[model samples]
Target: MGRPAIEVQGLWTQFGNQVVHKDLTLAVQRGEILGIVGGSGSGKTTLLRELIGLQPPSRGRVCILGEDIQRLSAAEQRRLSQRWGVLFQQGALFSALSVFDNIAFPLRELRTLDEASIRDLVMLKLRMVGLRPADALKMPAELSGGMVKRVGLARALALDAELLFLDEPTSGLDPVAANAFDELIGHVRDGLGLTVVMITHDLDSLATVCDRVAVLADQRFIAVAPLAEVVQLAHPFIRDFFHGERGDRVLRAAAQPASSPGGA
Candidate 1:
């Protein structure tokens, strides 16, 4: 296999005297959706920030798409950053910008496309994320929770980057909307041939969409495997997480056979 799409070696994150990650190491394969799950304060978000160069780690090497981010010059890092897209936890849309402009932001930053071309690309991305072209004129304030998430996803895809980092992508949606969003994520990943790293607390998402799940606990990743295998680990967190009533219900639902359309 080629080099991993993302690699972390002996990673450590410290704030004052508190250490969040210690000797953490991980590798994400190309074109795979890797879900990160951890309890509260397990530093899941911190790890995501570190991966995207938003937060620096006290000790460790982070290699993204084969380049070490810590070693990159500012200009080089800026260029490297364009190779991946990030969907922040809250969608992070500019309240002042319309949806059209939000998705167009990244494309416009390139400064190579004409207005007509930018508009065309923006509309294309909207359609790609299951949004109507007419909806592009609406501001973030006018959008529903699911719409906000879709807009954020559309903006993330505007660059056509090979990597996507999603921080709590389905956090605020209802069950139905969250399921639809999960389906959209799988569709987009497969359609774009993208490598996805998602930090999600949604069990249904981890069960249905993730190719593999990474469990974060006690300051590092305890296990990284397919959900089935990870749930089998003997750790207390794994037991509490997967064997709990809600977790068991979700897993049981995930394991059942899909009924055929129009079947009894």
Candidate 2:
């Protein structure tokens, strides 16, 4: 908590008369994985969009690395963008570009690296995400949903960003695939010492990866401690979400005392 890597103070966003976010404030520490969760239409994505400069907050301040992004000059903002990376929710890959080009896109646009160096860098990023060098030459359409997401992740790392934002990285994948993707995220963050801010509905991720979780509720974010504590919350939506219809049986078993040799 030594001066948050990302800070938001009194943030607000609106769509005409509709208020998406209000009086929102949050601080994310460097190298920490922070998870955001909320019901649909809760402005979770809106908050991320505002934080990353995709959309301006209707009011308030967003500071990253001690600089207010909204106040920065165009060139200054572009320069700051180089230090952060984003993976959109749906694996927003360029349909026409090959995976190699997609992964190299950020580096080529932001840096003055030569073609040879860019290729080397792209290949390294692809391999880091478990994709083979040969796979880099293939187009996005040729890859499966899971592979496409991994390629998007590789692209996010191309800029050598200190902060990474992933929007539903595990969505639409099978359970096993999603679990593998989660492990990859943890591994990548550890290997790169990256600070991750993710928006996810997956409780498993909260338990397995996130350092802290913030729930969007009543137009503000409230930090929930451990995954179990989050599960025990009294909010109707929170309880229904974490303890789905079938989850009650599991919870009861989990709460029950251990069996003894001569149970009464």
TM-scores, each model vs. reference:
0.95, 0.91
lDDT of prediction 1: 0.90
lDDT of 2: 0.83
Go through the candidates in order and give each one's C-alpha lDDT. Answer: 0.90, 0.83
Query: Which tens-of-lDDT digit does each residue in 27-94 have in candidate 1?
Result: 99888899999999999999999999989899999999999999999999999999899999999999
List the lowest-lDDT window of 10 residues for candidate 1. 255-264
The count of backbone overlaps in candidate 1 is 0
CA deviation > 4 Å runs, candidate 2 = 246-264
Which candidate wins on lDDT?
1
Off by over 4 Å in 1: 253-264
